[model samples]
Target chain A: MVNQQRFGLSLVALSCLVLTACDHNDNDEPAPMPPADVSYSYEVTVQNLTQGQPLSPVGVALHGDAVMWETGMPASEALEVLAEGGDNSDFIAVEGVLASATGAAPIGPGSSETVTVTVVNEPDTFISIATMLVNTNDAFAGITGHGLSELEVGQTMMMVLPVLDAGTEANSEAAGTIPGPADGGEGYNAERDDADLVSFHPGVVSADDGLMMSALTSAHRFDNPAVKLTITRTE
Target chain B: MKLKQLTSIMVATGLTALSGFSQAAELEITVQNLTRGIYFTPILITAHSPDQQLFNVGEAASTELQAMAEGGDISGLETAVDALSADTVANPAGGLLMPTAATTTTLSTMDGNTALSIVAMMLPTNDGFIGLNSWMIPEAPGTYTVYLNAYDAGTEANDEIRGGGAPGAPGLPVPPPLEDLVGNGGSGVTSEMTNATVHIHPGNLGDDEAAGGMSDISNTVQRWLNPVAMVTVTVSE
Candidate 1:
């Protein structure tokens, strides 16, 4: 009798399970869907326009109204690191950055690099891009506080960038001062032995010019408008 | 636009619309010294007809221009531009614009004046001046930026000495601010004007010694890079 009673209970349970499965039909309202994620993306292309100067890995970031470096102000430590050494790691990681990207390798003279950075759910209004000239003491070429809100998808803007001295290390052109492949010397020294204020770079003076102690040659010299850059919005 | 008036009279005069007549413009201007150490003398900003040029590259500089370039004397240029009926802002900084500083001024141009020019002598160098030659003012109402480069007047020899302030002076003028800043007892940098035509300045070659060096200017104090001046012009329609 007990076994029969248990069998009846099992049958009731099976029917209940079947009815429960049927009650929850496909017609039931689907769980609320999540909102879609939106993204903004940009591509920064930099061309090393010099004849013999190779650029360090390109550093690019989306920032606010604040400038990365000013003409007369002292360079930040992040800027000093990239200017002295050919390292973009610290520059792209600077404070107040929204989104940043860096080129994979050094860009040679007459060569170019294009890097893309994307931000989720918001538009990037300002973009700052910088790259070291690699062949001098603390010289870099860049554009800062460039407004990108006006840039539409597939629209590109072009500008020529002038080289600037970082004012961190002295422009001695000594045998062991430069950190490029041309010199293979020390990089990112903490000493601020130079003018201590950022300014346009005086064209490199080589041993052939007047500085008899310079390790550089005339081939390393460069004039203004050192690089041509184009920024485009991909998304 | 001034040309609009000419266009209206073209039919009565039995002619088509003629070019070269420019519209007057109101401009709010700012000049910033971008150098880390260089100073600028009295700046003269002018707006004139397109035909007038204050200083042209690849040509010999005018004597008036030489006076201003050598001794920071803008009176000659001031008087000359005034004769042309050009609108001007003279010495907006009131004195020497120090390194990495700026000056602002406003100019209301007369009819048919559409070109802009700016000039200032860079101190601590002989015959070295910062110049912008005849940039056409765009008819559009917007802000524009231009960089002015250092130019050699090719009139006086850049002796790097402290000499007279008249025309054909042999050295740079040591203003009060630069009196103690500049060094003495230097022989000279060069005595020759190799390029007697207006040209991009062969940059100052300063020496390390404070006294008795090849140049009186300090290698670290007075040297500068090109594009010494940054000009911003906001045109209001």
Candidate 2:
């Protein structure tokens, strides 16, 4: 009788297990499935070429059909903030960005950093990267709205980028205005005291160049094509 | 005899069709001043043969180039290129191309003339001019953009004062539009042409004092970076 009882209980348990699985299948709603994984990756390496200026944390973005800044046009507030303050948070978060990456730390003069970004199957995307020359008020260097759709995996593209004036702040180089280690005074003041249109940077006029109030020296001076960028599509 | 004549005529037609390598190109060229405060005097755009060059860096400027760089004169260079059978558009802007202004002209380039060059003087400087030297025209049909830099003709000392526009003059030639805008100088900046060959300009050094500074140009207003102008070429065969 005991053996028969054990057998009966085993049969009941098996029936319950089968019925529960059947009930789960027969339910009106099914569990949600995870989406497919499709990724396109790029590795961007930036080199700071200035003698005294340390570049801000580099921000690289992949977008479609947009320019972050243009010559003769007013800079967007995001660009102004980055140009003035050496901050890239707001710039990277600007709308219409598909994928983005930021360097972990500021790149010092002659130093380099690599930041990798991944997007979902966006092989035909335009890439823009920007970083501020930390010694100046509104000088930044990068390429904007450059087409990278033709760059295939394993192919590398290299460019020497020219410095551009954001035209948001005057290049006063005053003692208490520069944000770099040379001054350590201020960054990202909201005043638009200079020409509001973007242009190639005329370069900084340091104290050595007869600007009385400038805190910068001749070592802080820089010319065109301030930075070099190397980009490779990974996967 | 009739069949042989027909064959010869077909052979001639085939040979004519295969000789399409020297086709002419129609180009619409536009130059836009990208400076904030500088002005470009009358421009000279030319399409010439590959072996010819209006100006080359590291070489001394020709007298014709010096004339144009100092005085905004294109007639001398125009005459020289005309002798070479080049297609040219002289003074497309008709006068000074002001800051951030653009001017366009069309030219039909003849066969074997595949290079394009452009030159225009930048005002308020002794001999600074925007130059595009011997850029090869593309055979494909498309629009191409090029950025140009400022070059010093090394013909005159950059004495930032008012003076004559002659080829050997020392001071900047202040036009009527720039008379009051430029300053009066107490003394000249320097009486030397250091490089004495066509090279990149060292840019202007204008002080804030309008009447008594070493330079008459404005330090803040008249300064510019490289890539002073943008040229676009639209080509169609």
Q: Which stretches in model 1 have alpha-carbon errors above 4 Å?
A: A1-35, B1-24, B180-186, B218-225
Candidate 2 residues A1-235, lDDT tens each?
9999999999999999999887755566778879777678889999998898899999998999889988778899999989998999888888989999999999998999999999996767888899999888888999889888888889999989878888888887887788988899788988999788887777777878766678899999887678999999888
Model 2 stretches astray by more than 4 angstroms? A1-36, B1-22, B99-104, B176-181
lDDT of 1 at A36: 85
What DockQ values do the models have?
A: 0.25, 0.24
Q: What root-mean-square deviation over C-alphas does model 2 reach?
A: 11.9
Indicate the residue-level lDDT of B91 in model 2: 95
Give the per-residue lDDT of model 1 (tens digit) for B120-219: 9998888889998989888889999999999999998888877777887688788889887788888988888788889998878776666777778765
Could you tell me every candidate's TM-score relative to the true structure?
A: 0.83, 0.83
| Model 2 per-residue lDDT at A173 | 85
lDDT string, candidate 1, A1-235, tens digits: 9999999999999999999988866766878889888778998899998987899999998878879888778899999999999788888888888999999999999999899988777665688899998889899999888888788889989989888889899888888888887788878999999877788887677777666667788899888889999988898
Cα TM-score of candidate 1 = 0.83
Query: For each candidate, what is chain B's TM-score?
Result: 0.91, 0.90
